[model samples]
Target: MDRLTPLSKPDPVVTLDEVKANLRITHSEEDVLLARLIASATASLDGRDGALGRALMPQRWRLERDQFCYGIEMPLPPLLSVQAVRYLDAAGIEWDLDLTDVVIVGTDPAVLRARTIWPTVLAEPGAVAIEFTAGYLQVPEPIRTAIIRSVGSLYVNREAAAGAAALDFSGLDPYRQWAFG
Candidate 1:
């Protein structure tokens, strides 16, 4: 799975104003630096877990498979909706699968289950495409806090220090997806 739409604005996990407040800055001198740090921190946290937390903003993701498996697990969490599912037939004709044939289950890395059976696809890489949107309309409190702290930490420590204390990410660890089996 790959994110087709890289983080563009309309919504950011943490805004510039929010970051500035976290850093306790009242001036705009380092606005550019703060913005970059916020983006970097958000990207770092977003990719930390395989499938945990919401996107915090609407974004597109594409899941590709070599064939129509019995069950396909989505790669992102808190899925808001499944946009489309397109497949390449044996004859090399691309077709969109009917919504009735697919069922979405669970919010964390939403699972896509085939109703009866999965259709055949052209035997090749990425023969099936699943496009979906995952995220929250507003960033959750814990996630928002994590982003704020991370930006502050990154700003304070521009470079790694050999003996410096590690940035506490324990607050964010609970939000990660852990495998039990």
Candidate 2:
């Protein structure tokens, strides 16, 4: 089974002040509420589980696999760096692959390539793991705008609505990932 886990949480891409300004909320009375909304908005569209299927802020991730194929595709785009690769031997001993033994290639769909033959891995589930950092050092302006708009929609419409309070995601179309079989 393939699994992806976040090693660290990404800080909110949209600040409380920014959300407040977008909502024209000047009072500190709702600062706490606004902060929560900002976090929710950002989480809804950030990282692997996000709608964008991408990381918005710089964050670390671990990808676990049963075996190393010819090359491993770093699913998250805008990959910043590959930190480490590790595998378990047949005897269940963990070994760290030397960073010099692998290289990162490409941009749109970053890939991890082994410079040498891959070390033997245990023939079992999750025997190999790769740790890397991915995401934007600076999130795109449109992404930030989308989050703000989502928060605004949620704030203004506390009650469920059929359409009047729907969150607008038109700004996110260009950034959203569409997978095809």
Candidate 3:
């Protein structure tokens, strides 16, 4: 089984001020609610649990696997860099693989290609781990628009039925990882 853990999360993609401006909100009475809504909007589209299957802001993640292979697929991309590749030795001791031994291939759904043979590891679950950063340093405009529109819909229909706030998310189709590969 493969497991992905967020080592650190990115700052909110859209700020409270930005959301407020989008909604034309001029009062501070709903600042707290708007802040929460901003977080909610970012969470709905930011990282692994996000619909896009990619990170919107730069963030760190650790991906673990049972064993090392010639190549490993890194999820949540727009991969920025790989910090380290590690494995648990047969004796249950953690060891870091040489950085020069591997290469990062592609951006979205980046692949880690081993330049040499993989090291031996214990026969156990999550014996190999790769720490890396993925996401955009500057988020695309369409994504920002989507988040703003989503927050607007959520704010406007807070009391109505679910379908009442129907949002046309056709603008976000291009960002979905599946759309690229």
Candidate 4:
């Protein structure tokens, strides 16, 4: 996991040419949601503490659905479980690409030097393509081939969801549910 001057999100504005928009996520609202929920979540767990928080949430942002690019910072664990991915995916409004979009930004020099941290452990996204500032990276072929030989990546929500506590994921069916059909 690359590190930088610790900072909270609201990362500086990146021109459209700077982003790759891997999943065709064209709405600024989507970007905002991703930044806070996904990126912020990942960053929270990533190494570097206090400082990295500030930079990651820079207090502001600018978006352009008319543009897209890749490369960014995020925190991801190695022994990443399939269920974790599934839960995260389920949380998403809709996963456009076969992969998940991870945002990485930190304020630790050591992290940047390691470079191979989160991105290095990047797991296969099936057909999904993870995109960011560094570049829109597809789950390296080797990983996909390997995971294919593994068990499965499916999510199930047995309990009923309540108000406020309820998620607006009514549009998407469970990956397993659709598969069984």
Candidate 5:
């Protein structure tokens, strides 16, 4: 896998229509794919790595920029989360916890776990503006518990994903009561 931060080319620019076509909305009943696509494309850079993955991953792709710091990442999963952490552990990362972003693998029966056993990011004031790719979430306590155990963290319950489009961003808080409410 290649580092995602440093790029031979810019992050893939996605269109509203493109994301819309492939969008499986979870929270809102309106079109919000463009926002997600934009966020994903932006987050795919290495510039954001210094602060995000500085201490977590030992050897990271390094770069300097005025607008944004860049770092190349080995493509792992939907997020730089638990899935990547698990892979990194096997690939020789010399760490027990990542404590970064939520590790989200896929949209299907997707797995979500906190990157760190005890999140340094979550404790910080403005670590990351959390977002769920598959959107809405409403899993059973058992499943949530399993995921929490995977990352040595806890679950932040969320609504379920939608079909047509999204009205707004959901899963922004630990409580899933009013993201799109």
Candidate 6:
């Protein structure tokens, strides 16, 4: 693994209005603070468990690999599509691999398999670049509820006692990604 860069991020799963309503905030006094918290919480959740909630919104990511292999597993889950696969040769020239040569194998942490030819890459870091899209168009109810609960908890418990847990994410366990070795 070299670099996993986000080309585009999905629209926020929870809107400002929805969060405000959940917080029962009628005024705009804390709108900025709430908005910041919402973004922070969403990002935290998005990256949690290897981007479990990424399916709630379609996002594009660029994955850079140090070398080319027969199969490559993307870092994120719920892969929507592979945009392109390009590699840098030993001569420092870049070439695009045929899209038809690549196949998506699994859903959770989608795996890409090379069909006929696997290109040789430079013997350096970031020698291969794969751009792909993942995530969902609509947010799930459970995930939305979890976000709301987390935002509300953070808002209410901005100043929690030492050693106290601020938010309860137990409800999100069902939707969370569990890794198996």
Cα lDDT tens digits, model 6, 1-181, are 5577888867888988999998789999999988887776676668423335444578888888899887787665678888899999989899998899898898776778888768777898899999988786666788777778878988888887731254455667765666521
**Maximum-lDDT candidate:** 3
For model 6, the stretches where C-alpha displacement exceeds 4 angstroms are 48-56, 161-164, 178-181
**Cα lDDT of model 5 by residue, 124-164, tens digit:** 22222222222112333332232222211111111325321
Which ranges of candidate 2 are over 4 A from the true structure?
A: 161-165
- Over the full model, what C-alpha lDDT does candidate 4 score relative to the true structure? 0.24
Q: Where does candidate 1 have its weakest 10-residue lDDT segment?
A: 1-10
TM-score of each: 0.83, 0.91, 0.92, 0.19, 0.19, 0.85
Error of 4 at 93 (Å): 57
Count of clashes, each model = 1, 0, 0, 49, 28, 1
Against the correct fold, how does model 4 do in TM-score? 0.19
lDDT tens digits by residue: candidate 3, 24-63: 9999999998787777777777787887889899999988
lDDT of each: 0.70, 0.82, 0.84, 0.24, 0.28, 0.76
Scored against the true structure, residue 177 in model 4 reaches a CA lDDT of 18
RMSD list, candidates in order: 3.5, 2.2, 2.2, 20.9, 17.2, 2.8
lDDT of 4 at 157: 23
Off by over 4 Å in 3: 163-168, 179-181
Q: Per-residue lDDT for 159 in model 1?
A: 73
Clash count (model 2, backbone only): 0
